[model samples]
Target: MAAEETGLRVQEALDRLTGTGAREAGEDLVRELMAFYGEGLAALVGAVAPEALVPALDRPAAAGLLVLHDLHPEDVGTRIVRALDSLPRTPPVLVGHDPDSGTLTLRRAESGGGCGCGGDDEREVENAIACHAPEVTAIVWEQAPALLQIGSRPPTAAEAR
Candidate 1:
């Protein structure tokens, strides 16, 4: 099974167990741990000049970690541009963004030729967005690129009805 699928299953099981007064307690523990680690991360980040933090946040894993700790210094849009630029090939065109809803849409370039990316591309893109642009709650495809146009050339005006 995919790692994502396994993680989702574990989350579901955890949610089930939380129904018996365990949710609040579990949340308290997680909050305490997060507070502890987040403070340390914030201190380390704060020690460095703001400009110096870019290099550290540019790394995907590091970015995710800092974002989780709420220590990332960049805003969502900048992080998104950084994430999109990280993709191997030509990045898609961002069509629209709804800040209120955290919905972003992008259009695949036709030159991509129906990439072999499968579904992993979506998850990877989403994960990247979450790390840098957590405010973007969802990614939507504005258009799927076409490999070819089916219609032949249009006939001259004489054929018009």
Candidate 2:
């Protein structure tokens, strides 16, 4: 089906789920509908946001869901991460770095740790830290003064000069 048709279907399902005295019944219907259309929505998103899909394309299941619905990788990752983060305790950490630009993007990592599951979690963490090296460097630079203030004693006359 076309995107518009899919959207209309989803909207109608949502209306039925939320409309009138049968709120609970509608909610159940909405959940079922969401599960049924989730993959399609993912594919639709992927088609519109190809740049975002790059990161998720490597993962078979995630990529399949995206391809099935034409969703972007980034959107897949974002949604997955958001869902993961909402769970209680030990949220995964996502950290990205641009070395030359000295920029960092830090957020919770995906729930399942992507392909880096098992013992590789350490490596993943290290990689994230490395990616943010420039940001770390800047933070250190900014803290130097405060660190010096904390450690230094009063200067002698000769040192003051």
Best by TM-score: 1
Candidate 2 residues 1-161, lDDT tens each?
46576567666767665557467656665665655678566556646755764665445455555534444334433443443343344544444434455443444344543552334544443343333221222211111112233667789999999
- What are the TM-scores, per candidate, against the unseen true structure? 0.68, 0.24
lDDT score, residue 7, model 1?
53
* Clash count list over all predictions: 0, 21
Where is model 1 more than 4 Å wrong at Cα? Answer: 1-22, 115-118, 144-161
